[model samples]
Target chain A: MKKTIDTSGQACPKPVLMTKDALVENIDELVVVVDNPAAKENVSRFATKQGHTIKNIKDVGTKFEITILKGGNKEETEISAEEFNCAVLPSKGKTIFLSKNKVGEGDDELGQNLMKAFIYSLIEVKNTPSTIVFMNSAVRLCVEGAEALPNLQKLAESGVEMLVCGTCLNFFGIAEKLRVGNVSNMYDIATLLTSENTLTI
Target chain B: MEIVITFKLTHNAMKAKRKVLFDKLSAEIIPTPREISKECGFSLLFHDSTSEDVRDYLDTNELKFSKIYLRAVVEGERKYEENN
Candidate 1:
C-alpha cells in the first residue's frame, strides 16, 4: 500500500517526526513532501538511516516529494528521529568593543603596538564586525595622525559603523582631532554593549 | 608591491619607525606576519617605490632590522618573499 504525507510549510523536526509516524503505521511505501531543503535533507537522512530504500525524489515547484520504500532492503535498522539534525543556527551581528588604546596587559609600548596590529588585522578578517565601539583611550585610534586611522577609515568606508565616545574624546582634549567615526553618547554605546554580540577588548 | 622590514627587537622597530617618519617616508608599524616569523614582533610596511629611500634612511640612522620582505597579494592573500 502507498501513503503520502504533506509536510509542506512545517518546520524542521516536525517533518521528520511526521514522516517517522507515517512509517510506523506499517505503510509499505511512503511519500513525504517538504518545503525547504534542510527539511528535505533531514527527512531523507532519517528515512534512509531506518534501513529503508529511497525510491525517488521529485522536485515539484518549490516543494520536494520524497518517495521512500519500506522493507525494500533486507537489513532494516530502526533509528530514532532525533538522529537527524536540523541545520538552523542563529546568526547574530558581531560587534567589537574597544575600551582601551592597547590590546592586553604587560608592556605598555608592546600593548600599543599590538593595538595597531590588531586594528590593521581587522581589515583582513573574512567576517568583519558590523559595529566597532571605541571608548576611553581607544578613541585615539580614530583621531588624526593615529597609527590606526587608515585602517579605521577603510573599515568605515566598507560600511562598518564606528561609534567613538564623545566624552572620551572631550576628556582627551582632542575632540576636534576626531577623524574617522561618529561622536556617540553613552546611551548609544550602552545600548550596543547590552544588546549586540559584543567582544570586549 | 609593498615591503615589510622585520626587527630582532621591538626597540629597533620603534627606532626604525621614528627614523623613517622623521625623514617623511611613508611607513607604518605592523605586526610581523606569521608567514615571515611566528614570533610576536613588529615590522615596518612601506611601498615598493620607497624601498631604496627606506633602506638608505635606516642604514644611515643605524636602525637594525632582521629581514626585508617583498609583500605581494597572491590569490587575494598577502604572500611575503624575503627580499634580503
Candidate 2:
C-alpha cells in the first residue's frame, strides 16, 4: 500500500510529476524522497493540492522523505491544466537582495534612474518576490526622501516582506528616517540570503 | 486620486522635486507612466489636492513640463487623464 519514489538529482516538476503518477496506482500512502529543497516543496505542494495529506516530512542530511497519505476517493483526484502551470507555484523561497542605492555601475545619475525603473517594473511583474532585503546604501531606498520610497511602499502593501539593515541605517544616520520595512540585522539577512533563491542587485 | 507631472528634461524634473520637497509639499518622484510621453524618464506624483499649487509652483519656478495627468481609481482599476 506504500510506495517509495527516490527523486534525488531530479529537477522541479519531475519530482512532483513522478509523485503524482505513483499516487494514482491504488497506493494508500506514498513516500517521496527529494534531495533539493525546491523539489521537496514542489512535491509537497502538488500532493496537498491533489487532496493528499502530508503525514510527515523527515530530513535525513541532504535528503528529505515526504510521506503523504492518500485522501478519500483517490480515483477522483484531478489537477486542472491551469493548476499544473508552473507559474502558479508558490514563491516560498525567493528573495531580492538590494545592496546599493543605484542598480549598476557607470554614471551615478543613470544608475539611480535604472534602479528606480527596475523597482517599478518589479512591482508590475506577475511574479512578485517573497522578500526584498536592503543593505548598505540600498537602505536609503526605504527611507523617507529616497525616490523609490513610493514603489517600495506599494510593494510592501502587496505582501512583499521588506528588511532594512539596521547597521547600514545607523551608518547612514538615517535610522529614524526609515519609512518602510522591518529593521533587520546582518545575521537575519545572511540567513535569508543563504536559504532562499536570492537575486542580488 | 493621484496626479503626475512630467517634465521635458530630467534636470527640470529633479529641480522641481527638490523644490517640492523643500517647500514641504507631499510629492514623490516615480517612474514616468508609459502612457505619458516626456523627455524625463521620471515624474512627480502627488495627491489631487496639490494639483493647482504644483502647477503654480512650476510656473513661478519656470520649470518646463510636457504634461500633467490625473490618475483616478475606477472600479479597482486606474485611469489617467491629461490635465495640461
Candidate 3:
C-alpha cells in the first residue's frame, strides 16, 4: 500500500507532526512533498531515523518529493519514537558583536587579516549567527572602501542580519557610503545584545 | 558566473583584495572552494567576465596566487575549473 502526504507551505514541527501521524498508518511506502528546504531536510532526517529507507528524492522546481520504504523491526520504531521526542531542539538565538575592524590587539595588519578570515570562515559554516552587530571601527567594514564588504554582502544574502552603528558611521564621515546592512542606534544594539545569546569580538 | 582566485598565503590574499577594492573592481572574499587547494583559508571571487581586468591587475601588481578558476553551478553543486 502506498500513501502520499503534502506538507507544502507548512512551518517547522508542523511537517514533522504531520509526517509522524502518517507513519502511524502502517503504510508500506510513503511519499512526502515539502516546499521548503528546511522542511524537506527535516522530514528526510526524521524518516531515516524511523528506519525507513529513502528510496529516492526528486526535486521538482520549488518543491521536493521524498519516497520512503518501511521495513524496520518494531523495536526500531520504538527507538525512533523516543529519538523524535528529543530531536526537535529549539533554535539557538545567536548574535555576533564586532567592536573593532581588526580581530585582535597586536599587529594591525595581522589583526585585519584575521578579521577578514574570520568572516569568511563564519559564512562557510552550516549554522550561521542570526545577526552580526558592528560598532566603532567595525562600521568601516560595511562602507564602500572596506575589504570585507563582499563577504558581508554574501552573509546578508544568506539571511544573516547586519546591524551597523549609525553613530560610528557618522563619526567616521562615511554615512553615505554605508552599505550591506541597516544603520542602527545604541538603544537597538543594546536591546539585541542583552536579549539574545551574544558573542563579542 | 563567478571566478575564484586562490592565494599562496593569507596576507597575499588580503593584499590582492585591498588592491581590487582600491581599483574599484567588483570582488568578494569568500572561503576557498573545496575544489581548490591553497595555503590561505580565503579566496577572492568575482564575476567571470572580469577575468581580463583581474588578470591585468594581479599581474601588474605582482600579486602571488596559486590559481584562478571559473566557478559554475552544475546540478546544484558548485564546480570550479582552472582558468589559467
Candidate 4:
C-alpha cells in the first residue's frame, strides 16, 4: 500500500520533516505534497537522496505532488535533507527602477555618473530585490557598451530579473541592441512595481 | 574598503565623471541634495578613497562643470548615495 504525506500550507522545514517521517513508515510509495517551488525542490531532492526513487514530480503551481518509491540506490546525498533545517535561509526579494539616464535632475553629467554608482552598489546589496526595471533613457544603459552593463549583467546572472520597457527601446530605436534582461510591456510594469516595494530611479 | 569622496559642485562632478569614463571608475555623479537648499536636482557620488584621483582626473582633462556640496544619509541606509 502507498502512504501519503500532505505538507501543503506548511513551511519549508515542516514539509521536509513530514516527508521524512512518512518515509520511515512507508514501504513502497510515499506521496509528498508541498506548496511553493522552493519547498518542492528541496523535498524532492531530500527524498531522492534518501534511497527513495522519485517516480514522478507533478507541479501544481502553488503546490506539488511528488511520488517517491522506496529503497532505491541513488547517487545524490543527504545534504538535501539538511537544507531544511533551521539554519536554512529564507529567500529575499528585491526590485529597483532606473527611470532616467541620470539619477536626479540638476547637473546632467553628475546624474549620469550617480546612476552608474547606484547600479554598482546594488551588486553588494544583501538580500537583493528580485527585479530591476529600466525605462526612458535608462533603457539605453543596459544596451551594449553602456557603462552600467557589467553590473546589470552580473545581477541578472545572480537570479535578479532584468526588465526593460519595450516602448522605450522602440522610442530609442535600440531594441535589437539590448544586451541583457527581458522586454516587458505596460501591464507587466504596473504589476511589477505595484506588487512589490519598488525603488524608483 | 571603498574610500569616500565629495565634490564642491554637481556639474564639476559629472564633468569629472565624463572625463574619467561612464564606466570603469567606481565613482558616479549624484545630486547635491545636501549642498544646496534650493531645489536643483542631483549631485555626484564616488569612492571616498578615489576623491583625489577624481580631482586630478578632472584637472588633467580640463573639464568645467557645476559646484559640489555635502550630503549624508539623513534617512534610511543607502547603498551608495542618492541624488536627491
Candidate 5:
C-alpha cells in the first residue's frame, strides 16, 4: 500500500522527519507533498540520501508531490533526523525594536546622545532594517523637537517602515507632536516583532 | 551640503551638540565617519547653510573642536573634505 504524507505549509525538518518516519516504517511506496520550494528540495534530497529511489516528482501548481520507493540499504536509511538541516531563507530585512529613548544603560544623557548617533548611522548603511518600531520612551525620538527626528525622517523616506506606539505617545502626552512615522497600536507592533527577525534595543 | 564638526573627545562632541541646539540650530550627534577622522568617536552634523553662524557661535562659546569638514557623497560613498 502507498502511504501519503502531506507536509504542505510545514517548514523543513518537519517534512523531512515525516518522510523519514514513513520510510522507517518499512513502507514500500510513499508520496510526500510539500508547499514550499525549500521543503520540497529538502524532502527530496533527504529521500535520495537515505538510499531510496525517487520514482516521480510532479509539480502541482504551487505545491510538489514526490513519490519514493524504499529499495536501499537499511543502514543508510537509518541516518538521524538531526543530520538534516532546515534551509529556511530570511523573508525580509530585520525589524528594529526600540523600547527606550536611549541605546544602553548608565548615564541617561550619554545614552540619549548615543541613541542619536545610532539612528544617524543607520542613514549611512547600505542595507537598513525593513522596519523600526518605537515604544515607551523611545517614541520620543519620533516626536517634534527630537534630535533624532530628521534622521528618522530620512530613514522613513528611504523606504524603512516606522511604527511608533500610539499608547506610549499618549502616555507621554506627545501624540500630537509626532513629526515622523505612523502611530501604531500594539497589535500591529506585535505582528511585526514576531513575524520578522527583531533586534531589540 | 552637510557640515560636520569633529571633536577631540566624545563629551566635547556632546557638549557642542547641546550648544548648537541651544543657539537655535538643528544639529545631530553622529559617530565621526572614518572619512572624517578615526580618532574622534563622535561628531556633530548639520546643514552647511548654517556654517558661518555655527562657526561663529562655537567660537563665541569657546567650544573647542578638532576640525570641520564639508561632507559630500561621491559615487554613493561619503567623502569628508576639510572645510576649515
Candidate 6:
C-alpha cells in the first residue's frame, strides 16, 4: 500500500504539489523522493501541516525518502495549491549583524569578553542562524589568531555562511589576515539583512 | 533547534554559572543553533539532569535571563563536545 513519487531532479513547488496530491488521495503510504534539502523540508512541512504523520524520513546521500502515513479521512481534506504555498515557513535560518568586535561599548576588556560570551552563547542555542555578517570592528573576529575564529570556522563548516565585510577589512588594514569565509561587499550585506530575520549585535 | 536565553549582568549569576563550570559541569560554549539563529555566540550546553540545578541557582540568586530551550539535532551529527 505504498506509492513512490520520483521527484528526483524536479524543481520546487512541483515536488511539494505532487506530494500533497498523493497524500490527500489516502494512498495508504506515500514516499516522496527528492534530491535536495529544501525539497525535503518543503515536502516535510507540507505533510506535517496537513496533520499527516511523517512516519519516517530516510536519507541516502542527497536523496531523501519522506514516508508519510495516510490515516486521516479524505472527506475533510482541504488540500489546496494555495495552502502548500504557505506551508513552507521562510526557511529555519536567519541573519546576524555583527557591527562591533566587542559586544557592547565601554571598557574594552569587558566589551571583548562580552563579545566572546555572545559567540559562545550562539553555539549553545537551539537554532543556528543562516548567515553572520561581520562588519566594522566585528571584522576582526574572522581574522587569524582570533579566539572566536575557531567557533566561527566550525559554524561555517556546518553550512553557516560567514559574510565578512570587504570594506571593513580594508578599513582595518587586516584584509589579508581574513581567514574564514568570503569577503563580501555592502551589496550582499544589505541584501541579507533585509531579506532574512536579522539580529543586530 | 536550540533557543537563546539572555542572562542579566549580575555578579551572582555570573559567579554561579562559573562555579558550576568550575565544579566541572559538562558544559561548553557552542555555536548557536542555526534553526533558531545564526548569530554566533557563547551558550551553556548541559544535560537534562543539571538543567534544574542551573534553574534553581539562577532563581535563588535572582538572576534575570531569557528562557532555557532544548535544541533538536539529527542523531549522529558530529560536533565538538567538550569544555575549553
| Per-model lDDT | 0.86, 0.83, 0.82, 0.70, 0.85, 0.71
Model 3 per-residue lDDT tens digits across residues A57-142:
99989999988887644442323334334345568748999999998898897688778878877877888999999999999899
What lDDT is reached at residue B40 by model 2? 38
The TM-score measured for candidate 4 stands at 0.50
Q: Please give, as one word, the docking class of candidate 1.
A: medium
Give residue A46's lDDT in candidate 1 (0 to 100). Answer: 78
The positional error of residue A51 in candidate 2, measured at the CA in angstroms, is: 22
What tens digits encode model 1's per-residue C-alpha lDDT throughout A90-180?
5655899999999899988778888988888888777888999999999999999887899999999988999999999999999999999
- By lDDT: ranked, best first: 1, 5, 2, 3, 6, 4
Q: Over the full model, what C-alpha lDDT does candidate 3 score relative to the true structure?
A: 0.82
* Model 4 interface DockQ: 0.16
lDDT of 5 by residue, B1-84 (tens): 688888887788888888887877766788888776666488888875556766787899999888878888899877878866
Candidate 1, position A141, lDDT = 92
Off by over 4 Å in 6: A1-90, B1-84
Q: Report the poorest 10 consecutive residues by lDDT, candidate 2 chain B.
A: B33-42
Q: Is candidate 3 or candidate 5 better by TM-score?
A: 5
- The Cα RMSD of model 2 versus the native structure comes to 9.5
- TM-score per prediction, in order, is 0.74, 0.61, 0.61, 0.50, 0.66, 0.49
Computed on C-alphas against the true complex, the DockQ of each candidate is: 0.68, 0.36, 0.31, 0.16, 0.71, 0.18
Task: List each model's interface RMSD.
Answer: 1.1, 2.5, 2.6, 4.1, 0.8, 4.7
Off by over 4 Å in 1: A1-12, A21-37, A50-82, A88-94, A104-109, A125-130, A156-161, A170-183, A195-198, B22-24, B48-53
The TM-score of candidate 6 is: 0.49
State residue A174's C-alpha deviation in candidate 4, in Å. 1.0
Model 4, range A1-201, lDDT digits (tens) per residue? 798778877766778777777777737888888877777777887776676778998977767899988886445434444565534555557578888888799877556677876777677757777889988998999899887887889889989998999999999999999999999998999898888878887
Taking the true A–B contacts (Cα pairs closer than 8 Å), what share appears in each candidate?
A: 0.53, 0.27, 0.47, 0.27, 0.93, 0.33
